[model samples]
Target: MGQIQLQNIRVYAHHGCLKEETSIGSDYRVDLKVDAQLAKAAKSDDLADTVDYVHLNHIVKEEMATPSKLLEHVGQRIIQRIFKELSIVERVEVRVAKINPPIGGDVEAVAVVLSSSLPNFGNQ
Candidate 1:
């Protein structure tokens, strides 16, 4: 087993609860971690044997393009997509952050983190 991480993916998206936030949009950063069996890839050195980072980034970008009302919702969607699309992934962790959120205070960002594990379908 091994871990793969995609960190600090910057995206410009319109996602927030406020109307102004959705109209104006903001920068977002996404961090994702995946736990999977990497022994086959390590031995064979083949791309097919492991999860592709580029594909993961594409998925995140696609999800971010759609507007959502909350960071938690966005993060959950990302986690679900990773599990649904990536068959090799056993567990996934996703962090979604909105840069310079309008909270009426000096706040740099607001973030939501979500983690999920795939069920053992083989055993079932």
Candidate 2:
């Protein structure tokens, strides 16, 4: 198995509990990690054999375009989409961060992390 990491993807999106946040949006960052079997790609040196980072980026962007009430929901949707779209991916971890949240205090960012793995329901 091998891991692929896509870190610090910056996006301006409308995702928050507050009405102002959804209306104006905020700068956000996303980090994703995917675990998959990569022996074939390593040997063949072909993009088809591996999960393409560009495609992964597209997925993140598409999901981020949709507004959500919470960071947790946004992260969960991204992870679920990745697992559904990328058949080779066995597990995924996603982190969504809102930069300079509206907490009425000095804060750099607030983030939510979520992870999921495909379950072998039939095998068990």
Candidate 3:
């Protein structure tokens, strides 16, 4: 399987545990790694045979635009959306980073990362 890496994808999103964060919004950086068999696309050189990462990025951005209570939920939503929207994907790894978090203590970023595979692995 070939891998598609979409790293350090920045988005302005409203997602956090605190109410102020939700209303004010913050900078969110996402790194998505998608694993899939690209043999057909590689051989045929057809765009349809592979996942269109540009479209995938737009999907993730759309989900991030809406405010959510938890980053975990947002991350899961992103994962689910990828699986639901794209058929060529076999596995996905998502990392959501809240840049300049609202926590009391000083910090550069706080992030949540999640990885998941298709339910029917044997089919892959």
Candidate 4:
């Protein structure tokens, strides 16, 4: 198995429990890590033999565009979509971070991490 990681994907999104937070929006960051069989692609030099990172990135961007109440929800959607769309992805880990969150204190960001494996994510 091999891993592919996409880090620090920046986006502006409306995702928060507060009405003001959702309407005003904030800068967000998304990270994705996936495990797959890459030996075939490495040897054959064919994109079809491995996970397409471009597709994975698209998943993140699309998911981020949709407003959710919590980061966990956003992360979950990213993990689910990757598994559903990529047959070769054996595992996935996603992190959704809201920069300078409105927590009434000096905080850099708040993030939620969610992960899943093929067996654990069977049919959903």
Candidate 5:
């Protein structure tokens, strides 16, 4: 088992419990860790042998473009999408952050991290 990571993926999205946030939107960052078997890809050096990061990025963008109320929901949606679309992926870790949260305080960011592991089914 090996990992492929997409880090610091920045996007502007509408996601919050507050009405203003949902309407106006804000900057968000996402980090994704995908666990998959890399032996075939490594041996064959074929793009089709593993998950395509470009395609995943597009999927993430599509999901992020739609407004949501919670980071947890957004993160889960990403995880589910990866798991459903990429059979090679056995586990997913999604971290989403709101940069400069609207809370009236001095804080760097607020974020939610979620992870889900799927059955390998002897593929690895």
Candidate 6:
């Protein structure tokens, strides 16, 4: 198996339980990692044979663009989209972080990680 990681995907979006947060929005960081069979792509040297980072980045941006109450929800949506769009992906891990959040203290960020593996993944 091989891994493709897209890290530090920065974006501004509305995602919070507070009304002000949803209205004003906040800065976010997204990271994604996917596992897939890479032997074919390694030998073929063809884009079609590999997991596309552009597509994964697009998914993270698209999902993060939509407003959600929690980072976990956003993370799950990203994972779901990846698995749906990329059939070859055997597993996925997504991290969604809210930067300089509204919490009433000095905090750099808060994040949630969500991951899943395809059922019967070991059968291969």
Top lDDT: which candidate number? 4
Report the Cα lDDT for candidate 2: 0.90
Instruction: Return whichever of 1 and 6 wins on TM-score.
Output: 6
lDDT of 5 by residue, 9-119 (tens): 999999999999999999999999999999999999999998899977877887888788889989888888888899899998989999999999998899999888896
lDDT, each prediction: 0.90, 0.90, 0.89, 0.92, 0.88, 0.91
How much is the lDDT of residue 45 in candidate 1? 100
Q: Per-residue lDDT for 1-124 in model 3, tens only?
A: 9999899999999997788898899999999999989999999999999989997799789989989989998888888888888888999989999998988888999999988898753343
How many clashes show up in model 6?
A: 0
- In model 2, the runs with Cα more than 4 Å from the true position are 120-124
Off by over 4 Å in 6: 120-124
Against the true structure, whose TM-score is highest? 4
For model 4, how does the per-residue alpha-carbon lDDT over 25-116 read when each residue is reduced to its tens digit?
A: 99999988999989999999999999988999899999999999989988988888898899999999898999999989999999898889
The residue-level lDDT of candidate 6 at 31 comes to: 83
- Checking candidate 6 for backbone clashes, the offending pairs are none
What is the C-alpha lDDT profile of model 1 across 44-101, one tens digit per residue? 9999999999989999999999999998888877877888888999988899999999
Clashing pairs in 5: none
Backbone clashes, each candidate = 0, 0, 0, 0, 0, 0
**Native-referenced Cα lDDT, model 4:** 0.92
| Model 5 spans with C-alpha error above 4 angstroms | 120-124
Residue 19 error, candidate 2, Å: 0.9
Model 5 vs truth, CA RMSD: 3.5
TM-score, one value per model? 0.94, 0.94, 0.93, 0.96, 0.93, 0.95
